[model samples]
Target: MTPFEWILAVCIAIMAATLLSGLVLVLRTSDVLARAVLADLIFYTMICIFLTWTLTNPTSIGYEVALLAAIAGGVLPTLSMARIISRGRR
Candidate 1:
């Protein structure tokens, strides 16, 4: 494997660990706000894992999917903030 591959592997590993730990925290925590924050951590970590993977297995479709996922990922924080600001009002 090349240096880039090794770096990607390490980065993915770290993200995976973060993802798992965040999952645990989300499960154990009682506060609603804390769970919301941990959920974002888990979501973005999965996105990072996917992005790192595309580095090695480059594909045209992969880039398009990643772009879409990234845009969707942005939606999470926006909605979360909106909920927080409005205090969950419709």
Candidate 2:
């Protein structure tokens, strides 16, 4: 395997571990806000995984999806959190 592949593998491993831990945290947390934040972490981790996978095997379709995910991933979480906080304020 190439050096780049080795590094990518290590990164993917780290991201996977992060996702797992975040999932566990989300499951264990009782607070809605805490869970929402952790869930956002989990979402980003998944996006990282998808981005990493594309590094190894590039495809035009996957590239489009990855870009879309990257953009929507940021907006959705922020909007959702804002909505959640606004509701809580009522």
Candidate 3:
């Protein structure tokens, strides 16, 4: 394998580890806030995985998808958290 492939593999490994740990945390934690944050982390990790894949393969489509995923990853959870907090106050 080339050096770039090795670097990509390492990145993939790190993203996998992060995803697994985040999943474990999400499962073990009862706190809504903690779970939400972990979920967000997992989302970003997934994006990073996509970006790495795109970089190694040279695909515009993958980059576009990654961008969309990144935006959703940040925005949807934030909107959900806002709704949760607002409702909790009622």
What are the lDDT figures for the candidates, one per model? 0.86, 0.88, 0.84
- Per-residue C-alpha lDDT of model 2 across residues 8-54, encoded as one tens digit per residue: 99999999999999999988889998988998888888988888888
Tens digit of per-residue lDDT, candidate 3, span 65-90: 97688688777888887767676664
**What TM-score would each prediction reach against the true structure?**
0.86, 0.89, 0.83
- Report the C-alpha displacement of residue 25, candidate 3, in angstroms: 0.8
**Model 1 per-residue lDDT tens digits across residues 1-90:** 999899889999999999999999999999888888888888888878887898898777887878887788888687976797678898
For candidate 1, list the clashing residue pairs, or say none: none
Off by over 4 Å in 1: none
The prediction achieving the highest lDDT against the true structure is 2
Error of 2 at 30 (Å): 0.4
| lDDT winner between candidates 1 and 3 | 1
For model 2, the run of ten residues with the poorest summed lDDT:
81-90
